[model samples]
Target: MSQEPGWLRPHGEPWKRVSERLVYDNPWITVTEHQAVAPTGKSAIYGVVSFKNLAMAVLPLFDDGSTVLVGQHRFAHRDYSWEIPEGGGPRDVDPLESAKRELREEAGLEAAQWLPVMKVQLSNAITDEIAIGYIATGLSPVPTDPDETEELALVRVPFREALEAALAGQLPDVMTVAMLLRAYHMARERALPDALSRAMLG
Candidate 1:
């Protein structure tokens, strides 16, 4: 009989294991394993899942002060999602480039100016997906080139209303909300009193 693949072999419970990762080796992130004791004092192996991700989302702010959003389906959540132009790609791609691509693909809009607003982690307590948020300003409409599988609608909402939706828990995708919040604050940072100078500077 042939031996099973090293990664297919069991390391712990049926669902958890120190399996070979399915992503590239990026220096910013990697996995590690260690032994641990449960609260019940039972011994088990812990597999730390890690990888640096390039998650870019854009808030396309028109000169009119209305922001553009893209509505797409999220099969993982079994719901249609309305979000900023966003994507998850290999860490190899320039994050700003990813933002530009996503903006054009999803909303058919491009900005004359791009601001890198936030570099945040999805959930540092668990995964290692780093999200890069951007504020896209001075917009111009263009022909959309969405992925073949995409069926999306471009929406324009006022900046204040977008902020309200994000804060009122109406935006279901936490990641989108988080990034939009950052992008919004960053877009308005110049007008504010420069309270978060470091964040605004970056």
Candidate 2:
């Protein structure tokens, strides 16, 4: 490929991998060290964290312009956080199926309609973690089936309130923030159904 004189496109030599070995391993993730060559042709060492499962998030929308959110304590941050229902799906399994289960478990609701909204790369610098988000509608109640270790608190709030909270950093989860933004965009642009968009935009 030829490069233009003014601006550079993403066409360039990429990093070359000489070798890699697993340094840390767990049921959910693996950390590996690699002997690599940079695009500049220099020897370098790189470490990467690989997830065994795909990340899945579900945002349940109610008819009255409200959505359900879940609050829980996060392990890595060692703090309490509010987020949309989310979990990991086995790599070989369908992500939508995983989203359904997560919504039911965390929020005690099942959605009759689901829309794949976003696919995001989480911290691409060191972790190969990809997240898939969905907008779930037509919610109905079910028994909460949270993980035994999780003490989840569910809240039903207006979608506008949730978006404002995320903008204010009250909801800091990347998946939550991204999905809410996407939902707002879809609602404003009328990408979703008329009734759904009206409810969300209200």
Q: Number of clashes in every candidate structure? A: 0, 0
lDDT of 2 by residue, 48-135 (tens): 9999999999989998879988999999999999999999999899999999999988999988999998999999999999999999
TM-score of each: 0.70, 0.94
How many times do residue backbones clash in model 1? 0
Query: What C-alpha lDDT values do all the predictions have?
Result: 0.70, 0.93
Candidate 2 local distance difference test against the native? 0.93
Q: Candidate 1 lDDT, tens digit per residue, 61-143?
A: 66556677788878878888778788766777877888888888788888888877677877665576777877777688889
Cα displacement (angstroms), candidate 1, residue 69, comes to 1.3
Q: What TM-score does prediction 1 earn? A: 0.70
